[model samples]
Target: MLVHVRSDGVNAKYNEELATECLVWINQVTGGSVNTAGDMDNFYEVLKDGTLLCQLVNSIQSGIVKKVNNSKMAFKCMENINAFLEAARQLGVPAQETFQTVDLWERQNLNSVVICLQSLGRKAGNYGKPSIGPKEAEKNERVFSEEKLKAGQTIIGLQMGSNKGANQSGINFGNTRHM
Candidate 1:
């Protein structure tokens, strides 16, 4: 969860806070037996040779073994699930459908929650990588133009659409009959 964002100009400490919040939420939802400090060590141990889903299933099974069934735990689980989804959203991870499906307090829904967390984790891992910034894009464009020039080709940029067509400005096509 130690993400360096130098290339993207993101606040690494803030991202760490978000990651910690996500971990705490997962810990609470899983009754403190998954995604905790110790649990993550075990997770990494399994992750070296196994897939994410396998790691998730193993972690969830261990958590279930240690879970205490109670109304308070149930309530906290749901609250933490919501908080986790919110944190993931704030971190630019998409989990809307997964959240909607796994928000319930059914045991069968645990797999969906695991899947969502896996997806968020994967996206978070990639979040720190460099992107095509404006400067980089301009450089690429210049290089492409140079390549085209070297190949004796002229880049002809064309705009194919016009506003004078049947779909006029401010016209509502839905209001017309299809006769």
Candidate 2:
């Protein structure tokens, strides 16, 4: 049987000596050495220095293993439950027999949780793609043509002698609007 202990009380604030004693106690119980930082050098030159770093690193490594084992157990349990459900479906089992094997309400909740986890993973995967900033809408203003005249596209109603379009002559200075 796997021992499941809540980590609410185990934290880093414990004294280094006490933590080392706790590490020894845990290793004695769990058959795993709490020595993850055997290769790291101490800040000081003393050979047995940085005991706190060793304890913390070992504790972290053990915690990581425990976490991985817990997840694997959970996945195995889910897989077993699903397999039992599939076998029940195949054998045309009664509802009373399968109801005790798996709770449908809990299974529905687990399904929603799986969907949420999948969405989170998808969002994480999409985070690496480049983001495009908002683009402004282009205004539809008129564009003037810059083409050569080609003998037919000149402005209409203009004569050759520069007399202001065939009406005025010889510079009359009174009517400013007409000028």
RMSD after CA superposition, every candidate: 17.9, 26.6
Off by over 4 Å in 1: 1-76, 101-104, 126-143, 146-179
Q: After superposition, how far is residue 162 of candidate 1 from its true place, in Å?
A: 35
Clashing pairs in 2: none
Q: Give the alpha carbon lDDT tens digit for every residue of 1-179 in model 2.
A: 33232245432222334323333433443346555231212111111222222222234233311211112244544444444334333333334333322222122122222222122222222333221222323568975556654445665545544554665467768767843
Candidate 2 regions exceeding 4 Å error are: 1-72, 100-179
Angstrom error of the Cα, residue 154, model 1: value is 9.3
lDDT per model vs. reference: 0.39, 0.31
> For each candidate, how many residue pairs have backbone atoms clashing (under 3 Å)?
0, 0
- Clashing residue pairs for model 1: none
